[model samples]
Target chain A: MALADARALVPHLPAFPHDPAGDGAMLMRAVEACERYTPMVAPDGEDALVLDLTGCFEGQGWTRETIARDALAHLARMGLGGRAAHGPTPDAALALARFGMDELADLPVAALALGAEADLALRRAGLRTIGALAARPRAPLAARFGRELPVRLARLLGEEDRRITPHRPAGAIRAERRFAEPLASVAPLLDVIEGLAQRLESVLARRGEGGRRFDVALFRTDGHVARLAVACGRPLRDPPAIRRLFSERLESLSDPLDPGFGYDMARMAVPLAERLENEQRDLACGEGGEAQPDLAPLLDRLAVRFGPDRIRRFHPRDEHLPEYAARPVPPESGPAAWPRPEPGEPPLRPLFLYDPPRPVGVVAEVPDGPPRRFVWRGKHHRVVRHEGPERIAYPWWKHPEGRGPTRDYYRVEDEMGQRFWLFRHGLYASESDHPQWYLHGLFA
Target chain B: MTDSPILRLGSRALSAPVPKGRGVIGLDVPEVDRWLKGGLRRDGLHEFYAPSGSPPGPAMALALLAGMRNCGQGRSLMWLRARGGRRKDGPHAPGLAELGIDPAALLLLELADPADLLVAGVESLRHGGAGAVVLELRGRCRALDLTASRRLALAAERSGTMALIVRGDARPVPSAAHTRWQVSAAPSRALPANAPGHPVFDLQLLRQRGGAEGLHVQLEWNREQAVFRTPIYGDPPAVPAGRAEDRRARRAA
Candidate 1:
């Protein structure tokens, strides 16, 4: 009449039971639900999750026993059958929850399975229940099960104690708040979010670290929940900066918590973290003050308001042709510096660059310096002073079709003092195709 | 008869009002001072037109630094868009320091974007407290003109600073400046007996107010001492009379 004998008589159960959607899938969903409490939730096996609730329990105002019971109840509510136990080691907890729940009064060595040899020794001693098994002399158990069995038994009974060290993901931080009363409305929720962000900022500042990706979760009444997530281009710890990124994400949520009954708690967690060095500006010539503005928040705002593709930065390609110089890239992903043309080259370049060089008509013949007259966009311009024939050849090695021609660029000033940077796309030297002309840029 | 003494006292007080001075040194003369004023205005825009194809020299740059250092203390002098010269190619730090300008007080902006340069200039002018702004443009000054110059001038005035635009030969006329200067290499000095002579400049005072047109002045720049002084001739040198009139006729043609 022992717990192990009872389990053995019932017959061996599969690691997971078959459901229409699969038990593994359901367990995965349940594990994801645990993220509402902490982002440090990890799957222990096919059917269980190991949650590092050390820091989380204090905020929940719950003891370890209460947390364990509540987690069992939560799983039950989700229609998942599972048992829970609070113990020092993961192995001990699993064993207790699986085979030592009944016969709480009897300290049974036989009930606990310490492999085949320990099972045989316990059978010979006629001991059952954790209480009875622990009360017996440890010397005999050590001689039978080796040193590991006794130490593990003490840990299981909460006597000799062990610690379950939780695995923390890299670049992670956390902030949380528990409300005395369920809170409703966006204003108060924002206030709580801001407070949490400030706490995270101070923590990160002390550690010289910052968070690149953050998750904000609201644990609502009746176990219903809402969450907001944001990803930044760079790691940032400034409170205002964090708020700016989150505010946009907050505005994008559909079916936003109407505080339909209010959220009982809120928390922010950093899943992917980074260390940031303090940045100091130069006092000389105010150049330090002129650094490029942080475009992350703006891009986030745009992505929230007008989809992810709305915000972009120009990235130039490695080509000599003016039209092929640049392309648009998502603002969130780009190098620190924009590319520049090689030095010591004189081709009249435009200040306000166009994406593709616009083609124009010319009346000039082959071997021409530049057109004396060209009509662009249905308007005629007479060139007065002209300079160039600065040749630019396409990279033939990369392009099999070969970029058509060697461009002859010109710096032409018109009668109205408007300077144009025009180029003939193909030269007379290349016989593969028809030569073309294009108006590349305008000089201010 | 009783009112005579009171009337005389009021008249004397009105007539004895305090007289303000003409202008600051390197800031008052025509041709030279006019450009200097724009270049040295508590906050103003000065434009320099260097010959096309010829890069700027140390002497020209040092002359600019001398004017900039007179603004005030703790003022930052920023060089926006450095062209033609590398850090080692030019006498950058020590040259400015030799002109009584603090090299540490300078900010070198190696931006390739013309728009970025303009934006920096505008920001510095708006904020003030900065000592001076020097921008070197490879092409012409068509992008920066009278209206932009005026806006910059107003900003400098509000901030109490200055803006110097150094451009190539193809630059258009700047309308907002008090004066514009075209700087070119002057003839080198002839060696004198028994003494190592310093180099002298054949400065042509081009474009000044009150029609102060002349190319007669010869300035000897003492590099060691960082001073510009008129060189003393041993005796009264022979004058080339009417050379100015001859030069005017040649320009008209």
Candidate 2:
């Protein structure tokens, strides 16, 4: 019915426009808020949510009924009216919420959320309640009303199994701290983190494992949650090291943390872990003999401060293209053997090279003579000596574009005592009449 | 004086001092090594600067680094550049490898802030694993003041790691650097005519603490021998008049 007609029938009737988008955004916010109770919270359609509280409240001194009541109360405080039910399966809990179980066999058929046509058909057939529907022959009922009715009925009556997918991954090991008064400063929060780290260290140590990823969830009193996550370079169980990593991370964030009202609770969790074993320390000659540089801690501190992408190790690639000759990879992941120059040889190449070689005006003898003098960056230099015509052909197979031609490189020294690596783009006779020259590199 | 043996021994000890090997790195060249108070000091900051628009400062710094890397076999080196000063086309590994530097032994860090360059330099020196730390900053940086240089020098002294700072096109300022060199590119030798020869540098020692300054040397890097050699004919090479005569005689024959 239209709102105008409904309002005309009842003089004082309240109505509002349907807003599905706004409702969906509010539903997501509610799901995030419900994570405090359990990480395994899923949005069940638009009006309901499913939480697997199987092991969530273990040792928390709360039973299923109390937890459900608290959850409803929490939602009520947020200006939302909610009803909850506990059952062995999600379908049973959903059915129980809309129907009373005092007379278990007599619940109305409308609670099944089936189509209106199906409800009316069942009513016309004298199947008024669940018990009445159960008394009828299964095949005729299913054939008339479709097969979904019996399946949903079976799931609701605990005859079929059901499952829910959590919105976020559940933590394998978690430790939470609740405060009587909210924490407003960084020091106390860091103290709490240190305590939690120590606790997690012991737990990980018992299983001969260490945490690879640690996440801290901060719950503010104003209903805002801030999450901080730090990843370890290796499986780490040291509390001090973990604390230092967090300190560096917190200090390096561009957007500083602001405790608007204060954080009421904070929880730390290990989402990923790996096996680790302690190494035997060398007691004899321990002072100076052991010179192994422990680079992991330093790398971890740097990676936490400046993102992992910013800190990388270079690897020599087996390619002739100047740019493709080297690649940057994550530290500790590159190949062990890196290419090196022959011992005690003067450097054959320039110390610095400009990628996509910069253009420079060249004055050379006719044909293929080296540049007598070159003008680079608006500066004229008289070349006292020059070397080269080191011809490097383009790898035509790799680059099908074939736009690039063979280049002849020369190392030229100017009067100012500077050496430059210059190249001609193409041969004068074979490639082009006007072969352009470029400054490719500098020899220090 | 000859009456007491104790007095005579005291006088002999006072006259002859012990040959100390502190703060000196040998260049293996007799003339330049003797001129540098033994060699480049390992305990203090050495500044390499070139005029504005010139690119020889980095070259000189790299040459020195190549020399040091060869001397300290197991030690690593850290190279830092200001993030803003770095071009997408700055230094490539293949090029550095050609300069006789092991890419694995060099840790290159492009810091975000110019101030962080100095900090990283000091830290790298203090880390002790690196044989030397090279910091390249373009133009002038306000954060790299006297105090920062002093801190770097102190760190270098304590850790015995050589500290080299390369500056571009900036006037010399008051710094804690123990030695300052003004390097510029010089004309190379004409061995094979029209072909570039080994790198030639006109390095001027502008300032040296507790030592004479205003010393200039023409040094040539011998790629085959891996050492710096003083040019035999100094410079200009007598205009190479004899080479032209030889070419004319061969044509006549």
Candidate 3:
């Protein structure tokens, strides 16, 4: 027990300081690397990892034993030793892998990961193996050893189940391919993507559905993963279109995909799916048959290159304020019908409106009459003709900041034939004695 | 006044694909028709340049766009722009409706990068699903040089989709556009002392592919008839000529 005796027993022993942070970070890298197997890999503890292989391994024609063996081999290559086991539940598998093979009956109850004090108490009671503890009467054990004893015993025997949360959400459908030799070029990778898309298309077709989003993940030989995803405006099952979208998506990536080493495996998954019904096309009328043109393709390409937010259509909002009357919504939203104008009538509003009303100096004859002259952008303009003093009151309940008397809007034409939409912010008597005028919009 | 809709269109007709082809839409004015060599060809790019310190280019662009929309039936329009341009605010729907353009038939894309806007505009032209594609770019976009303009022009020609690029407060740059015009607001014909009339524009033909250049025209938009007209034939004065001056002189007296 002396330091000299221990050193003499193992004279070549290496020692280093404890590094919990380094160990934790290494464990996280291992977890990320293991995602090549399944997206649902999670770090169980400091030394363990949990993978939910519910429906994934079966698709590859691999049994649970092979999956475990492959996982252990993978970690071994990473310079870390690991033990893996498959059970009916995560708790059961964890207990078995740490203790021994199916010989769970002979292992000590301490293998259940119970706290040290409880384990020592069970040992003092002459309960050596899990079998001895499980053989005891349920009621007496609960009363004497505590409630956790029976629960732990049941879980170890695969009677009770425990849930494990995956680090990443599992996709609805997935297809993958592993190559004997790693691929380095984009052409072959794109071919693989096409094949995977076809596979996904069949899967979607069988389910009478379509995929709205597709994610392609490449697994490098050096344990790195690069993922690219594309979204469609409508439910899509076409392989070529899906491939084209992926190509566009790959080009649009800010950080280009780099195969540091080489990619060993590639996978495609449909994370979001929607129901789509097939429709017939009119050949005679051809492209002109549809009343509203199909702009979805154009919209999708633009959205992928730029962003969905950059491309949009206007929708009517239920607001009284001029600025709030309309809002930009996604292109998928149906646009509201514009009000039609009667023949021989001047425009109701200006073609372009200033987002934030620009302030302008005004000179008026009467207290509440329309502006006779105005100064905009340090330029003077004489109002030759004026249309209205249309009063638009503020919705006090909605906007407390705009809680004032009604705004008087006038459509006026200056001497230069330039028309403007200007409004007085408040009234003379109620809100403010001297109201301010704002240049709001311009006429066509 | 003519009973035949075809007669109303006069001898100049749009390039017809079929014998009854409605391919090219005209501005219905013989002067502009002769100037444009049969109105604006549907299969090309039109550039409208509003010079610096002017407010009329945007208005003229809208009027021309309204006229272009009249050519195609049930055809939608797409307008693309950069986010931080001079007029970042989008077109008001009510205003567009008053110009005879259904806002429902329009798609507006506001992008941060001018390059993306140009690319998207060209791509939209290629699709030809929309009747026309309009790009509102202010100042100079390095990405939209002569080469990009030519590419867009070719795409529009190939697809038969009318393309219009409206540059605000920017001088004419080297472009391969089919036609280029400089537009500025001009005072309307003297009306009654205080009455307003139709909008008037002083339009100068800066460049045209195979047509005469250096031609100037004073144009007015007839809101009631929804047509473009030369100012030579003016409508009855809304207000008596010099009425405002007469009133001012009277007040002075």
Candidate 4:
């Protein structure tokens, strides 16, 4: 049979059950594996992959025909049947795969085309062989079949006149499943999310890539779409990390995802990916050298429960006053380093520092030293050993609310071993009749 | 003949065999190690009490990591269980690396759930060929019973690893292990001519297996080298008997 006759049988092929697209994924994987042999490869529709082995063939000391035979053998091992032809262009190889006059000529014309349109074209032309099609004038055939036919024909003849463009694979993989039943509660949805995340992770692992952002789509029974997306500060493959990120976004979902009938389906996709290398650190010595505690996960959970905007870290501002020294910032948007206190500063710093220092009343204040006695939390306590009057002045440009005040912080040890970090808010200037004292944090 | 009897008594006292080989170095004060049979046992859980208002938690944890880095070949993994609570408020990664630990070898597992933290701890202990496991919890871990501790101990023993538990203040004692220490900030020392100031800590040996008990050691942390060293103490002034009495009373009060 001639090549054109075989090429014409493509449209009329009957669909095979359980062979949708004739194992496209398997074929792609096999082709990708072959890329180590040569970088240039193109898919011939659904069933075949074409490799440009011109430069590679010489290095292997094999003729083009011999290399084609080895490629077919490798495909056979992968349970795929294919025919290869060495042509100058990708389009030519594809055409040759369809209708080359090789030993594969015994395969039916319908098998080569793989569908019905080719069969109809062959019948209309009354062409039985590729030789017959080659006999026709190029101009008429181009007019009758449009531009693709002659271009494809020229490629098959090893003419380098036409260029073949290969399709690029998707940068990231995505899969979606529409449920027959809508999910109403959090439990079932969590199960689906877990499964989806696992599948996405496996795909990424195979590609040697990790995802930093993922999007989950919830298609409701009422035809509404609810999409959630989460981003990680770093690329991660650990399922727990992915789950935690998703949980945060899920909690903040605004339009109550009511499963009217239920969510029809959930689709998970990796929109962005990055290559990540594993990290390693040296171990500490002694019992103290054991693992240190990580607070990120807890912060993530808290940010999910409370809105992300509500949670913040106290960053010590580069200022003198205790109240002006610290600012609240979103958990995600800050440097990892916590600001250090200056030398000769007050000894005591509170572990749990409040945003705005709460006010208290002080009975006696000595210049250049801590308060002698103070009323805090509705009680009186005498300072035994007091340090400081570490004076902190405000930034003149960015005045705090209800400011016009400078603070003198003191590290006062109570009768007990317990210590208190207190500061007088206003200066001793007579212009301000009332000076306020505030309690900031407690020292361990 | 009387001298011979005295020599025999002296030999017996020396032969009682002081326990001092097990406590973790660079962590327990010399006196605390004397009580702990050495330092913290090489393969057991050492719990720390971190009250909300305590500075000792971060200080002790940093000291522990520094010690482990000194002893072990590779990086250490720290499993933090609470958010915002386990801030590496002091001694960030770079600071730790300068202290002879490879920062690249440190693996920080910041997990949200306590169950996940436990699982990671077990898995890391089992597979992570690192030297130690540190768990920072909000309160006492009632969940970590004797059985769990034994399992963790067995894992550590098999891997020749160590586990440190830093529990928040108010947590009741969970399970007994090799050593337990409580830490508190001592007092700050004056800065030198132009150097950054050092943080001073009074590490009290609350519990130990064999060494001295109720011992206090003062340490000054050098920020630049990321190392800790004993500070020089001034000479003790001679006091009048009445003044001495007053000093004792004030201390007791």
Best by DockQ: 3
Per-residue alpha-carbon lDDT of candidate 4 for residues A400-420, written as tens digits (9 for 90 to 100): 564567777776655433455
Q: Give model 4 RMSD, 1 decimal.
A: 15.9
In candidate 3 the C-alpha lDDT for residue B120 amounts to 86
Predicted structure 2, TM vs. truth? 0.83
Candidate 3, CAPRI quality class derived from DockQ: acceptable
Give the alpha carbon lDDT tens digit for every residue of B112-209 in model 1: 35654565576656655456767666576555766777777677667656777766545446356543455443322222211112333333334433
By lDDT rank, best first, the candidates go 3, 2, 1, 4
**Share of true Cα-Cα contacts across chains kept by each model:** 0.00, 0.52, 0.55, 0.01
Ranking by TM-score: 3, 2, 4, 1
State which candidate, 1 or 4, has the greater TM-score.
4
A1-444, model 2: which lDDT tens digit per residue? 988899889979987789999898777767766777788889888888888787877777768888788677667756677888877778777767657463435677876679899889888978888777767777887899989889877776677878788888888787888788988876677778888899998888888998888898887665567888888778888988888888877887788888877887888899999898887766774676435344566556666776665555567888765656778676657334565554433344777767768998888877577888788888898877566666777888787886577889887777665778888988898898889999888777
Q: After superposition, how far is residue A285 of candidate 2 from its true place, in Å?
A: 4.9
Winner on DockQ (2 vs 4): 2
Model 2 Cα shift for residue B43 (angstroms): 5.2
Candidate 3 — which pairs collide? B191-B239, B192-B239, B192-B240
Give a tens-digit lDDT track for model 4, residues B1-253: 2112111122333345445454344343343333344455666666666544443334344435433643354334444453444432321332232233343344455555565566556655654354677766665556677777667666766665677776655343645555555655544432221111234455555555444445545555554444455554433222224323432343334
Q: For model 2, what is the alpha-carbon lDDT of residue A319?
A: 77
Per-residue lDDT for A118-151 in model 1, tens only? Answer: 7776667775456667678989878866888777
Which is the winner by TM-score between candidate 2 and candidate 4? 2
For all predicted structures, in order, the TM-scores are 0.46, 0.83, 0.85, 0.47
Compute the DockQ of candidate 3: 0.36
Candidate number that wins on lDDT, 1 or 4: 1
The CAPRI-style docking tier of model 1 reads incorrect
